[model samples]
Target chain A: MVDWLTMTIQMASLAMAGWCLVSTFRDQPMLVPHLVGMGLLWLLVIGQGVVSAVALIGGEGPEETVMYVSYLATVVLLPPACAVWGFMERSRWGPAVIAFACLVLPVLMVRLEQLWNPVV
Target chain B: MSDTTAPGRALRTGPGRLLVAVYSVFALAATARGTYQLATRFDEAPAAYLLSVFAGAVYLVAAVGLARAGRASRRVALVSCAVEAVGVVTVGAVGLLAPSLFPDDTVWSGFGAGYGYIPLVLPFLGLWWILTVHRKDRARAV
Candidate 1:
């Protein structure tokens, strides 16, 4: 995994979380900006997924291959899932959904790192 | 009490919708992890694996029940959340007191420390949403 890409995703996700929290606190609905922001984050995640999948195919896969793949799937799926659900709600808490998903991104990234480099 | 008796508010609206999202994630996580563990090495830790399955089941039931937003669904949600709350606490304590009982980490082991303790808090949040928020929203509607 590219360290800078991972760091950029983490920072971007947290920034989205912060933006969503502001919307939530202000009792505002999830507007187009939030959706766009989340879309950007999702793109980054998908990019990471493509890179990692290519690496794995090239034999740089983690020891816990199954777990890593599942987590990778999770990282790829979450933003879109959250965005669709949030759009369905049309309430302040809609952004809260995005916020929650964003927060989970870093945690998943940390897990990915661990899975990639399991202690011998 | 009245809110519990009131025609049962829609759990897929407002904050309840967000709760549904959270619960759905946990349900997916627990179920996926449990199935993987059981499929790969059930013999290594039957107790923990079984508990993982149980936790996943509870989350799934609760999330679906909440989303359905019916009287029976409300009951299902309540029961599942109650079960989850009790399961997390009891399993957490047992895992701490008798580590041998859990050779592997279940969703509730160490009070869900592995999963950032969201497992420990989720059921309470579920209960609060079911019991209190519905009442408050109903009152506001009146």
Candidate 2:
């Protein structure tokens, strides 16, 4: 279940990132779609964070606790922070920021997976 | 609201602000991670953890300086970026040469290899952006 949600979120983020890259290159405003994509992404990240936290408190291994917690915190904080920063920049760069944020999502997901399955 | 006006005119507006935002995020994350690692297990890897803390401090100072947007702030940002660039390169080289020095991971470990080399690239970008802004300001003054 968590894996499916994580995959969906990653796909959505990738799509948004592609859109943002195109929009930035084409000098588009990127106010609407970026906002929508980012909003959804934020919700997904928060959900992941909650699930991870619950799992952690429910006697997850301490060896991976710190890494999981740190990653969760970053995921929770990233979207809103990017939103504020993107909104501040009124140029095509606004979407560029969104693109950068989107790019980070997949990398973060990869890291999360590594933490979840250390042997792999 | 003249677009051409210089000095104290929003240093971190437009695309530049995005850079600042990214830097700020890194600053906060690195600081928190470094602090946690240091406090919890200093004996495990003192060198790596201390470098992490220093990297975090550099990021924080750079973010603050860029966001402030003044002459002094520009200087501070420039200096911070310079230091960050040197630190990343030096630490990265050292990490590669002597893996034993870092029993654990630092942000600059392997030239930010864990973080997609963004740490290595970020300082250069930051320095370029700050210098570009300064150049624009100087042109306006002249």
Candidate 3:
């Protein structure tokens, strides 16, 4: 895994999560800008997926190929899925949903790192 | 079904939507893990894997129940959440008392320490949300 890319994604998601939380606190619904931010985050996740897939194809993947692939699929899907769900929810909690999903990303990244380098 | 949900007051609306989103994510995670484990090596740890599958199903049902607006859905959500609370407590206790009983870690192992204890707390939160937020028509039923 590319440490810099993973760190960048984690940082971006955290930043977006902070913004979404602020909106939620202020009783604001998710807006267009939030969707755009989600789109950017989704793109980053997709990039990670592609990189990981290529790495796996090159035989430089984790021992648990299925687990890694499954996590990758989920990582790529979450942003868009949560974004659409948030869009349908026209309330302050809409952004809260995104914020929660963003928080989950760091955990998933950590899990990905662990799966890549299992402890002996 | 009990009654038509009030406008903007359905369990699927507002903050309830957020709860449902979280539940759905857990559902997906648990289901994926359970399916993978069960398919790959169910014989190695049948009990733990079966528990994992059960937890996944509970989460799925809870998410669906909470996201649908109806009396039946509300009942479904209530029952699922109750079951979840009981299951987590029982599994956590069993895992703690007899760690050897489970050859592998289930989602409820160590009271969901792997998932940051969210699994332990989620059911209580669900129950609280249902009791308080959807308390309108269910008062008599309760």
Q: Is the docking of candidate 2 incorrect, acceptable, medium or high quality?
A: medium
In order, what DockQ does each candidate have? Answer: 0.52, 0.50, 0.59
The segments of candidate 2 whose C-alpha lies over 4 angstroms from its true place after superposition are A54-63, B1-10
Higher-ranked by TM-score: 2 or 3: 3
Model 1 lDDT tens row, B91-113: 99998799998999988999999
Higher-scoring candidate on lDDT, 2 or 3:
3
- CA displacement after TM-score superposition, residue B84 of candidate 3 (Å): 0.2
Q: What is the per-residue lDDT of model 2 for residues B1-142, given as tens digits with 9 covering 90 to 100?
A: 1374646455677656777877887887688778888898999997788888899999999988888857888888889999999998998898879889887988888888977898999999988888887787788778
Model 1: how far residue B11 lies from native, Å: 0.9
What TM value does model 2 have? 0.88
- For every model in order, the TM-score on chain A comes to 0.97, 0.91, 0.97
Q: Which runs in model 3 stand beyond 4 Å of their true positions?
A: B1-9, B137-142
TM-score result, candidate 1: 0.90
Residue A81 lDDT in model 3?
Answer: 96
Q: Could you tell me which 10 consecutive residues in candidate 3 chain A have the lowest summed lDDT?
A: A65-74
Q: TM per model?
A: 0.90, 0.88, 0.90
> Model 1, B130: alpha-carbon shift in Å?
1.2
lDDT for B96 (candidate 1): 76
| Model 1 residue A90 CA deviation in Å | 2.1
